[model samples]
Target: MSVHEEISKKTNKTWGIIQTYRKLDEKREAEIEKVILQCQNNEAFSVDQINKVTEEINSFAAINHLPSRKFVTKQMVEEAAQN
Candidate 1:
């Protein structure tokens, strides 16, 4: 697959895993600060730690590939309106 597609797929997969095991705190916006994992267990992972693990999937891959904001276009808006 293309790099863009690969990145998107890899990033999304990693994000999904993160969502299942951990989540960014209220102040994590725009910053790879801390992601609390297993809140009841007091577990957490930092950006660096996450990157280290994600790198196992791809040498150049990192959890940071996740999108910070949704991209929307006129066509997309129209498509959503149709739906």
Candidate 2:
């Protein structure tokens, strides 16, 4: 399978996992939303930076079946683009 296909499959699986964990209660969903907002509001990451970082991390995770910590660096992006 192509990298894009692999990524799509992994993302679908992950979303399924998330959906399974979602509660029917509004309070539960609100709590989850609060945590998500807190993380997104972190001073270190602007909205654009967060989106970029999340995309790269998810891309790497989906492609490699690894955690975000193992994501390729900016240098790797440059190198890959140059090739």
Candidate 3:
């Protein structure tokens, strides 16, 4: 597979696993959705911001050899929230 295809497969597989375990907590989901919508409306989610976040997450996973959900860190979440 190509490098792009490999990354895409990995990402999709990871998200699939995450989705299986995710509990649909309505309130939290709604809050997250609201924040995402606000960011979208404000054009706060820029391409560089996305790339930085993705790089950080990928680095964390590579350094730790962690599974997808475990790749998420408090620091990562905080950085994303601030952006």
Candidates' lDDT values, in order? 0.41, 0.47, 0.49
> Ten-residue segment with the worst summed lDDT in candidate 2?
20-29
Q: Give candidate 2's total backbone clashes.
A: 0
TM-score of decoy 3: 0.29
- What's each prediction's TM-score? 0.27, 0.29, 0.29
User: Clashing pairs in model 3?
Assistant: none
- 1-83, model 3: which lDDT tens digit per residue? 89999999999987864453343223334444454555546544333433444454455555546443222343444455666
Tens-digit lDDT track of model 2 for 2-46: 999999999998886545333222333343344445444542212
Instruction: Output the better candidate (1/3) by lDDT.
Output: 3
The runs of at least 3 residues in candidate 1 whose Cα sits more than 4 Å from the true structure, single-residue gaps closed, are 23-83
Candidate 2 residues lying further than 4 Å off, grouped into runs, are: 24-83
Sliding window of 10 residues with minimal summed lDDT for model 3: 20-29
Task: Give one digit per residue, the lDDT tens place, for model 1 in 1-83.
Answer: 89999999999987786563334322232232233222223454235443443334332223445433222333433343344
Scored against the true structure, residue 68 in model 3 reaches a CA lDDT of: 30
Decide which is better by TM-score, 1 or 2.
Answer: 2
Residue pairs with clashing backbones, model 2 = none
Candidate 1's displacement at residue 1, Å, is 1.8
Off by over 4 Å in 3: 1-45, 68-83
